[model samples]
Structure formats: C-alpha cells, structure tokens
Target: MQITTEVVSGLERRLNVTVPAQRVKSQYDARLKRVAKTAKINGFRPGKVPLSRIQAEYGQGIQQDVINDLVRDTVFEAIEQEKIQAVGMPNIESVDVNDAGLTYKALVEVYPVVTVNSFDGLTVERQISTVNDADVDTMVDNLRKQRQSFAVKDGASADGDQVTFDFEGSIDGELFDGGAAKDFKLVLGSNKMIPGFEAGIVGMKAGEEKVIDVTFPADYQAENLAGKLAQFKINVSQVETAQLPEVDAQFLQLFGIDLAPNEGGIEKLKADVRKNMEREVKSSLRNQLKQQAFDAVLAANEIEVPKAMIAEETTRQRKLMLQQFAQQFGGAQQFDESMLPDELFRDKAERSVKLGVLISKVIADANLQVDQDRVKAMIAETAESYEDPSEVIEYYTNDKQQRAQVEAVVLEDQVVDHILAGAKVTEVTVDYQELLKRNQQQQG
Candidate 1:
C-alpha cells in the first residue's frame, strides 16, 4: 500500500491512497471461497458450484463491496500514517479499480494547532454583590406575595387588581374564534390580552357594561387579526384586591419549617433563604466570570476552526434546537428537521468550536485534569436542590455518563481558573438587584 497527502486548503487535506492489486485479489478470492461453500443454484448443489459460474454471477458485486471496505479501512490507516487529526468523517472524492491498483482520494478537514502567548495582559471585570438586609426583606415580601390571597372588592377595578368578567369580541362586526369568554379572571396590568384590553377593563365597576376598542399589533401571531381593530363588549362581575399572608407559624409551616427545640421559626427561615440566595448569587457570579474568561481567551487566540467541525457542531446544535422546539410545541415526531435552516446555527456553532479548540489547547498546555473532589462538590451542590440529595448523588456517582459530564464541567472550570490566575482582573461592585437585572438583560 502507498499513501500520499496534499494540503487542499486551510485545515483540509486531500489524501490519495493506493492498495496493491494482489491484496484486493486475495480478499476477493477469500470471500468468494466462503460464499461458494454455501452457494446454491438451480442445478448445482451446495459447495459444488464452479468458480467461473460464481464469478460470473457475483464478481462485480463482490468487487464493489471489497473496494468500499478497503477504502473505509485504508483512509484511516493513511490518516494515522500522516499524523493528521481529522475532525469529521472524510468524503471520498474518487475511486478507481484498474490493472495498476485500487486507488482512492479522500478529502478531510484536520484540527488546527492553537497557540497562546500569555493571559497576563488580558483584563476582565468580576462583579461583586452582597445580599443585604433589604434584599432579604424584599425576598421575604415576594415570598409573602406568592402565598397571598384575594378578596372581592365592591368597587372599580384598578391596576394590580384581579377582575372577573365576561367579554365578547368581534372584528368588523363579525365574531371570530377565541374572541369570547365567561367568568374569566384577568389581572389588570398583566398584559394577558391585547395592548388596550386589560387597560380598558380598569375603572370598570361590578355590573357595569362597556365596549372596548382594541387594535391588534401589526406583528400579532394570529395573521387574520393582525393590525385589525376589534371591539369587545364586556360585563364586569367582580374586583379583588390582593391580601398577603402574615408571617406566622402557618406560613413557616408552609415552607417545611417547624418550630422544634433547636429550630427557630422566622429567623431560621430567613437564614435558610439567605443561604440559598447566597448560593445562587455565587453561582451567577461564577457563571459570569467563566463566560468573561472564555471570551477573553477566545479573543486573545487566533485559530482557524475546521469547517468540518463547525458543520458537525452546527448540525448538532440544529438538531438540539429542533428537539427543543418539538418538546415545547409537541412531540418529536410532530416537526420536520428541515424546518430549521443550517445558517441559523452557523455563527454560534463556529464560535463554540473555536472556543472549544482554544480551551482544549489551554488544558493540554497547563496539564489540567478533572479534579475528582471538585466533581463531587459540584454534584453535591447540584443535589442540594433536590429533596433527596443522597439519592441524587448516588445516581450521579453510579451513572458513568453523568459523572463524566460533571467532570467535563469541572475541567472547564479548572481551565477558567488557570486563565484567571494569569489574567489581570478587576473587581466591580454592583448591587444585588442591579446585578440580577444586568444578568437578566444579558440572558434576554
């Protein structure tokens, strides 16, 4: 066998391989012999068919199979011999079977070499936040609101009030589907309806009747009603004001807290809430820092990402997106994979692949390995959210894939820490609310 490689372009290698005719002949003859042992024909018994007849019947088919197997086997052998780190599967450009030999050309994309000088000059801001008394008080108030009750008020509906009413809507004097409801409870300012529908319900008193004119937005999901003006005839039945529950034993019991010998009532609850909030704040801060570190490393490194890798990642991302759509909209079988265009994921996939390459290089250079203690800690932290933390931990510990996934995350964090160790870092203090708001905005 003889192999040769040519650099077709960036990260792409065109490999030409030639297998000896004798090798092909030997494998073909062996396969023919195996087939002939059990060969059955109209007039010949098993194991009695002539070689010429068998060749005449199955020669081309057997030859094609042999060539395909040889091509599949030899391409990898040639790649290994050339010391190429191929990304995705290779595309066979051409194949020839002649007197000279069995020759084939394979086009493949190889992984690029990544280099980083130093992370000492890179700068990133780390957000610092503390959950103060006011923040805890606000959280407690929000919790109270979660368990709030409402009582019917004999007055006009107002913002933050829940109104129960019956309404019939029509467009251009003709009623449409889903344009009417009875005894529907709507919160004023909730924006559950069209822009003006909720506002129109405000100021309405029980037993009062009115017609509200609302224009659907131009980009409404319902094409027939988009940009159309509709009139809703509504009859208000009730208005209710929110009533929050007092901080008492009942409220504490609601959160699974009991006034035992050592457990304090509201104070213990507040402390637990504060602890959870602190955990969450630390998690959010760590996520932000990791993202910043990754972005910094990505910006500092210049590497040519393999197109094949990007394409593969794009395909994976597209499938994942389609899966999410299926889960959100219906079952997996309900949607077609072709509905999502590949271009939708190209940019994200490219960036992800580029960063992955850079991170891998950093990990190799720094000799960063997945820390078992950190993996266990992460698993424990994750399990803290579950009712049975021990069960969750056991599940992860027993499942190899789950444990590996956690290890990968821990390894990535190690890389991030390595980057932060050398990178110039600046701490930026932010209020808890401001940090949360900024995080939400970035996510959005």
Candidate 2:
C-alpha cells in the first residue's frame, strides 16, 4: 500500500491512498474462495458448488465487499501512518479500480494544534450566594400562589384577580384578525395582553361595560397593529379575587409532608425549601463560574477553530433544538426546516468548538484526570432531589453510560477548577435574586 497526503487548507487534509493491485486481487480471491464452499445453486448441492459457478454468481458482490473493507482498513492505516488527528468521519471522494491498483481519495478534517496561555493574570469573578430566610419565605409564598384558588367576588377587579369578559377590538372603526373574542378570561396583572390592555381591565366591576383605548407598542408582533391606537369594547361578566392557601397542614401535605405526624411541620417544610434553594444556589454559582472560566480560557487562548468541527457542532445544536421544538409542538410530523437556519447557531457552534478544543488542550497539558470522588458527589447531589434517592444513586452506579456522563461532568468541572486555581480569582457577593437574574440572562 502507498499513501500520499494533501493539505486542503486549514485543518482539512486529503489522503490519496493507493493499495497495490496484488493485495486487492488476493483479498478478493480469498473472499471468493470462502463463498465457494457452501454456495448453492439450482442444481448444485451445498458445499459442492463449483468455483466457476460461484465466481459467476458472487464475483461482483465479493469484489465490492472486499473493496469496501480494504478502503476502510487502508484509510485507517494511512491515517495512523501519517499520525493525523482526524476529527469527524472522513469523506471518501473517489474510488478507482483497475489493473494497476485500487486508488481512493479521502477528505478528512484534523484537529488544530492549540496552545493555552498561562492563567497567572487571568481575571475571573466568582459569584457567592446563599439562601436566606427571606428568600425561603419568598419561595414558599410563590409556591403557595402557584396553587392559589379564586372565588367570584362582588367587587372590581384588581391585580392578582381573574376576570372573565367579552371584548371586541377595533382599529379605526375596522376589526381585524384576532380582534374579537367572547367570554375571554384574563388575570388583571398577568401581562398576557399588550401593555395597556391588561391595565385597562383593572378596577372593572362585574356586569360592567366600558371602552378601553390602548396603543400598540412599536415592536408589536402584528405589523398592522404596531404603534396603532385600538379600542376594545369590553363587557365584564365576573370578577374573582385570588386567594393563596395558608401554610397549614393541608398546604404542607401538598409537598409530601404530613403535618399530622410532625409537630413542626411548617418549619420542616421551610427547611426543605431552604435545602432545595441552597442546592439551586450551588448549581447556579458553579455554572456561572464554569461559564466565566470558559470565557477567560477562550479569550486568553487564540486558535483558529476547524470549520468542520463548527459545522458538526452546529448540526448537533440544530438537532437538539429541533428535538425541543418537537416536544413543544405536540409531536408535529415534518417540521419546516427553513425556520431554523445554520446561521442561527453558527456563533454558538464556533464558540462551543473553540472552547472544547481549548479545554481538551488544557486537560492534556495539565494531565488532568476525572475525580471519582467528585463524580460520586455530583451523582449524590443529583439524586438528592428524587424520591428514594438510594434507588437513583443505584441506577447511576449500575449504568456505565449514565455514570460516564456524570464522570464527564466531573472532569469538566475539574478542568475549570484547575484553571480557576491558576487564575486571579475575585469573589463577588450578589443578592440571591440578582444572581439568578444574571444567570438567566447569560447565553451558552
């Protein structure tokens, strides 16, 4: 076998591999010989089929199979001999078969050589947060409000109140699409409607009738209604006041806490809420730190990323997004592919590929290994939230793939930690809500 390499621009390589004709003939003849033993025909008995008959019946197929196997084997051999760090699957450009040899060309992308700079002066800010009693109180109250009940009241609607009404919206004395609905129900402060629409519902009494004038914002989704003045003729049919459930025995029971058996059930529930909040705070903080670490590392280390890698990552991100949309859209068969273009994910894909390369390089340079203890801790933390956490832990412990997933996470965390240790780190104390808000605003 003979191999030649070509540089198809940055990170892309073309391998022109040629296998000697004798090798191809030998492989083909061997495969054909194996088939002649049990080759059956209309008249010949099994194991008694003639070689000429077998050759006539299976010559093309055997030759094709041999070529396929030889192509794969010789390509890998060429890659190994050339010491190429190929990325994704190589593309077979052309294959030729003749008396001289079996010649084939493969297009492959190699991993770029990346060098990570020292993190001695790199600045990374780590957020420090803790769940306070007030935060716990707010969380419990929000949970109660989520399960809140409402009753029809003989009064005007107010914020947190639900009102059912009939409304007909018109723009300049002309109705438009989606301009009218009968017996529509809305929460007075839900912001489900345009800015002024919900505000107009406030202080509306049951069985009342009124006309509300609202101006659509310039950025309204509907082009025709954007920045236009509209009037809604509303007939209020019912007004219901929101009532949050008390944090008593029944309310505690909703959270799987039986207050009858426990004397301090409410307090215990508060502790549980605080524990969950603490877990959230820890996870969020770690995510923020990891993101910062990744950004710092990427910025400090400059490397030209492989376009093929970015394309692969982009394809992966697109697939994941489509899966999410499928779940969201009620399993609609056949999606409109045009809705999500490659450009939408190109930036993220490039960033991801760059970070992955940088991280892998650091792992190699530092000779970092996955911490089994950290993996166990991470798995335990994940199982903490599930009922029968022992079973959850057992599942992860028994499943190699699942545990390997956890191990990967731990290894990544270790990489970030190693970078943070070498970098100039500053701790920033932020309000619990403010930290969460910042985390939510951050893009991957």
Candidate 3:
C-alpha cells in the first residue's frame, strides 16, 4: 500500500492511495482459503471444493467486499497517521478496483492553521448606563400600572384610557378576511392597533359610532393583508380609566419588598427598581462589548475555514432552528415544513458556522483552557440554584455529554476573557431612560 496527499486548499486536502496488484492478489488468495474451509457446493463436501470452482462462483463478490473494507480501513488509518485535525467526514469521489492495483481518492476537510497577535490590545467601548431618580420614578409608575384596576367612565374616550368596542371591517366595500370583531378592548395610548386606528377612536364618546381607516404595514406578518387599506365601522361600548394602586406596604409586598406600614416603601421600591435596572443595563453593555471584540478579531485575522465543517454546522443549526420553530408553532402536527425556505436560513447558518470556527481558532491561538475548578464551581453554582440541588449535580456528573457541553462553554468564556484582556476598553456613562428606550426600539 502507498499513500500520498495533495493540498487542495488552505484547509482541504486530497489523499491518493494505491494498493499494489500483488497485495490485492495475496488478500484474495487468503480470503479464498477461508472460503474453501466452509465451501458447500453440489457434488462437493465441505472443505473439499476446488479453488477454480469457488473462484468461478463467488470470486467477484468476495473481491469487491475485500477491496471496500481495505479502502475504508486504509484511508482512516492514513488520515490518523497524517495528524490532520479533520472535521466532518471525508468524501470519497474516485475508486477503481480491478485485477491490477486498486486506486482510490478522497477529499478531506481539516482545521485551519490559526495565528494571533496583539489580541490583548483589542479596544471596545462600553456604555455605562446608570439608573437615576427619573428612571426609578418611571419604574414605580409602571409597577403601579401593573397592579392598577379599571373603572368604567361614562364619557368620551381619551388618551391613557381603555375602550371597549364592537367593529366591522371592510376592504373595498366588501367584508374582508379577519375583518370583524365584537367587544374588542384596546388601550388608547398603547398603540396596540394599527397606526392611526387607536388615535381615530380617542375623541369618540360611549355608544357613539365611528369609522377608522388605516393601512397595513408593507411588511405585515400576514402577506395577504400587507399594505391593505380598510375601514373599520366601530361602536364605542364603554370607556374606562386606570386606577393605580397605592405605594404602600401592600404594594411593596407584591414585589417581595418588605417595608413597614408607615415607612417610606415608595422610596425603598424606587431604590430596588434602580438597582435592577442598572443590572440589566450592565448586562446589555457587556453583550455589546463582546460583539465589538468579536468584530475586531475578525477584522484583524484571516484564516481558511473548512467547507465540510461549515456544511455540517449548517445542518445542525437548521435542525435546531426547525425544532424551535415547531415547538413555538405548537407541535409537529401544526408545522407546515414547506413554509420555511432553506435559502432564508442558509446565510445565517453559514455565518454561525464561520463564527464557531473563528471562536475555536481563537481559543487555540490564545492558549485558552477551561479550568477544571471553574467548571466544577459553575456546576455547583447551577445546582445550588435549583430546589433539587443534589439531583441536578448528580445528573450533570453522571452525563458525560452534558458535562462536556458545560466544559466547552467554560472554555469559550476563557477565550473571551483572553481577548478582552488585550483589547482597549473605555466606559462611558449613559442614562437608564435612554437604555430603556433602545430596548423598546429593539423589541419593536
């Protein structure tokens, strides 16, 4: 057997292997000997069949089987011996088996050679948002609304009030699909209805009739309804105003905030709200900084990624996404598999694969390793957070795959920290209200 390899690309290789004719013949002869021992043919007892007859009967099949096994075994051994960090699987494209030497060729996708320098100098800017008095007051008001009660007001509807209405919708003078509803409740300032629809209802009094015309957004979720102009004939049933809950001990108790009956529960709740808001603000800032670090690294480094790995990762991502979609859409029974296009997700899948490769490479280049102590601590912390702490710990310890997954995350964090250490970091103060507004915009 002879083996040779050629570099097909930066992270790909082609292995060419040849088995000499003599070697093939020797193996065939050895297999024939084994066959003779158990030979069962007409007019011939076991172990007594002629070699020529056996060859004539089953020679091609045995030879083909032997060649297949030999090729598979040799290719794997050769790859291992070459010390290549192959990902996914090798694709065999050419194989020739005959009385002469057997020749086979396969393409292998391997890990890219990665190098890193000046990773410690990565500079990232973080928005340091602080919760101020205004943020605290706003949070308290939101909490009050959360516990608010509604009372019917026999008057015209106004902003910051709820209105109950029965409406018939029409498209081009004809009743349209999903166009009619009875006793729909909408808040005037919530913007729950389409643009201008809620505004059109604000000045109308109870028991009054009105027509609200609004156009659907171009990118509306329902394709058939996108950009469609429709008139809703509505009857205002009743108007109600929200009555906010008092900021007393009872109100504070709703949030597990303990305070004396006559104490300043309002101020205490405000402080608590500010603390929570600051935590969330910092979390968002950290994520932004991490993203910046990733971009900086990608911009400074160039490495060849294996196509085989990308294809494998793409499949994995698609499977995960499809499973999540199915779960959210109720179940497999309700899922229309054809509704999702492979083209729609392919680009995102590829990017995820590329990022994974980059992360792995960065970890290797930076000598980042997951400390066993840290992994154990993380497991212990997670277990402590659960009611059945011991059971959770036992589950993780007993499951090798789960433990390995956790360990991988720890390793990735180490890599992130490594990059962060060398990167330039600047912290700037930001208002909590501004952060909240950005969050709202992102959700919208």
Candidate 4:
C-alpha cells in the first residue's frame, strides 16, 4: 500500500491511497473459500457447493465488499500515518480499480493550526450594578401580578380586563373553520387574536351583543383569511378585572417563607427578593462581561476554521432548532429540515466554531483544567432552583454528559477570567434597571 497527500486549499487535503491488486484478489479469494464452506445452493447440499459455482454466482458482490472494507480500513491507516487531524468524514473523490492496483482519492478537511495572540492589549468594559430597594419593589410588584386574581365586573371591559364571549366570524358571508368559538376568554390587550380583534372586544359591556369588523393582516398565517375583512357577531357574557394579591403572610408563605422574623413578613420577603435579584443581576453582568471578553479574544486573533467543522456545527444547530420548533409546534416526527435554510444559521455556526477553536487554544496555552470545587458549586447553584436539590445534585454527579457540559461552562469562565486578568478592563457602573433594559434589548 502507498499513500500520498497534497493541499487542495485552506484546511483541505487531497489524499491518494493506492492498494495492490494482489491484496484485493487475495482477500476476495479467501472470502470466497470461507463462503463456500457453508454455501447454500439449490442443486447441491449445504457446504457441498463447488468453488467454481460460488465464484460464478457471488464473485462480483464478494469482490465489491472486500474492496469497500479495504478502502475504509486503509484510509484511516493513511490518515494516521500522515498525522492529519481530520475534522469531519472524508469525501471519496474517485476510485479506480484495475488489474494492477486499486487507487482512490479522498478529500478531507484538517484542523487548522490556531495561534492565539496575547490578550494584554485587548480592552473590555465590565458593567457593575447593584439590586436596590426599588428593584426589589419592582420584582415584588411583578410577582404580585403573577399571582393576581380576577373578579367579574358589571361595567364595560377595558385594557387588562378578561372578557368571555361567544363569537361567530364570517368572511364573504361564508363561515370558515376555526372562525367560531363559545365562551372563549380573551384579555383585552393580550393580542392573542389578530389585529382589531381585541380592540373590537374592548369597551364592550356584559350582556352586550355587537357585530365587530376586522381585517386580517396581509402576513397572517391563514391564507384564506389573510387581508380579508371578517365580521364577528360577539355576545359578551362577562367582563373580569384583574386584582393583584396583597403582599401579606399568605403571599409570603406562597413563596416558601413560613416565618417573617420581623416587620410583618414584608421585610423578610423584601430581603429574600433582593437577594435573588442580586444573584440574578450578578449572573447577567458576568455573562455580559464574558461575552465581551470572548468577542475581544476573537477580534484579536484570526484563524481559518475548517469548513468541515463549521458544517458539522451548522448541522448540530439546525437539528437543535428543529427540535425546539417541534417541541413548540408539536410535530417532532413530521418536522422537515428543508423548512429551515442553512443560510439562516451559517453565520452563527461559523462564529461558534471559530470561538470554540480560539477557546480551546486558550485553554491549552493557559493549561486550564475544570475546577472540581467550582463544578460542585455550580451544581449546588443549579440544584437550588429545583424542588429536590439533593436529587438534582445526584443527577449531575452521576450523569457524565451533563457534568461535562457544566465543566465546559466552568472552564470557559476560567478562560474568560484568565483573559480579564491580563486584559485592560474598564469598570462601568450602570443602574440596575438600565442594565436589565440593556440585557433585554440585547436578547431581543
């Protein structure tokens, strides 16, 4: 066997593997002999089939099988011999089989040699914020809204009011599927219905009967109803106004605070809310800082990521997106990958691959390892959110993949910390609300 490799382009290698025809013939003959020992033939007893008959019947198939096995085995051997750190599976360009030899060319993408520059010159701004009493009050207000109740009102429905009604919608004097409902409850400003639907229901009083006209948006999901004016004969049954729960002992107990300690549980509840808020604020700020550091590192270093790696990452992200869509829309088995274009995720996949390469290099250069203490702490922190903290901790400790994911996160944070240690970091103090608003904007 002889093997040779040449560069096709950036990170791509063309490997030529040539195997002796005698080797193929020898293997083919050996497999035929083995098959003949237990060969099944209609005209002859089992194991009594002649070699000539077996060769005449199964020679081509046996030879092809032998060649496939030989090629797969020899390709890996050649890759090992050449010390090529291939990314994805190799593409066989062509195969030539002659009496003299069997030769094939494989196109493979090798991992790029990544060289990360020093981070001393990189500058990243770290935003710091504190969860003040006002932030706690806002969180408490939001929590109260979450636990709000509703009371049927005699007056007209308004914004934030829940109205229950029976509606029959028709377009062009013809009723369509899913155009009618009985006793459907809708919030006036929820926007659950199409444009003008909620607004039409608003200001309607209980026991009122009215005909509301709405025109569907041009980009509506239903083709039959898109841009069509529809009339809904609505009979409003009841209008309910929202009533937020008072922050008292019952509410505090609802949040697992059995004892108040002092100040009629309000102080304790505020303290707890403030603590959680502080933790969340700190986490968000750390994430922002880490992302900035990651961007800085990438901007400082440039490396050609292997197309194979990017392709693999793209496939992974595409599958993840499909899974999320399936989970959200309830058609996991029926979802088609074609619905999502590759171009949609190409940029993100490329950046993810590049960052992965850069982070790996940083880890190697800095000799960073996953800290067991930090891993334990992370597990504990995660378990805090679950009902059974010990069970969650046990699950992480026993599950290798889950633990590895956590370890990777911890290791990435270590890399970020290492970068921040040497890099010029500017501390920017931002208001808690402003920081949260910025985070929301970025997420949006």
Clash totals for all models, in order?
A: 0, 0, 6, 0
Backbone clash total for model 2 is: 0
List the RMSD of every prediction in angstroms. 3.3, 4.2, 4.4, 3.7
**Which of the numbered candidates is closest to the native, going by highest TM-score?**
1
Cα lDDT tens digits, model 2, 132-197, are 999999999999989999999997889999999999999989988898998898988777899889
| Regions of model 1 farther than 4 Å from truth | 165-184, 191-200, 207-236, 318-331, 372-402, 442-444
Write model 1 residue lDDT over 1-444, tens digit each, in one string.
898999998889999999999999998999888878887888999999998888998888888989999999999999999999998899999999988689999999988977876998899889899999889888999899878788989888899888999999999899989999999998788777889999899899999999999999999979999999999999998899888999888899988888875779888889988988888898999989999999998888878888888888999998898888888998888777687788889999999999998888888999888899999999999998788999999999999999999999899889988999999999999899898888878875
lDDT of model 2 at position 25: 92
lDDT of 2 at 4: 89
| Model 2 residue 311 distance off true place after TM-score fit, in angstroms | 3.3
C-alpha displacement of 50 in model 3, angstroms? Answer: 6.8
lDDT for each residue of candidate 3 in 294-328, tens digit (9 for 90 to 100)? 77777676555776666666667667767888788
Alpha carbon lDDT of each predicted model: 0.90, 0.90, 0.79, 0.90
TM-score of 1: 0.86
Instruction: Look at candidate 3 and tell me the lDDT of residue 105.
Output: 92
Clash count for candidate 1 is 0
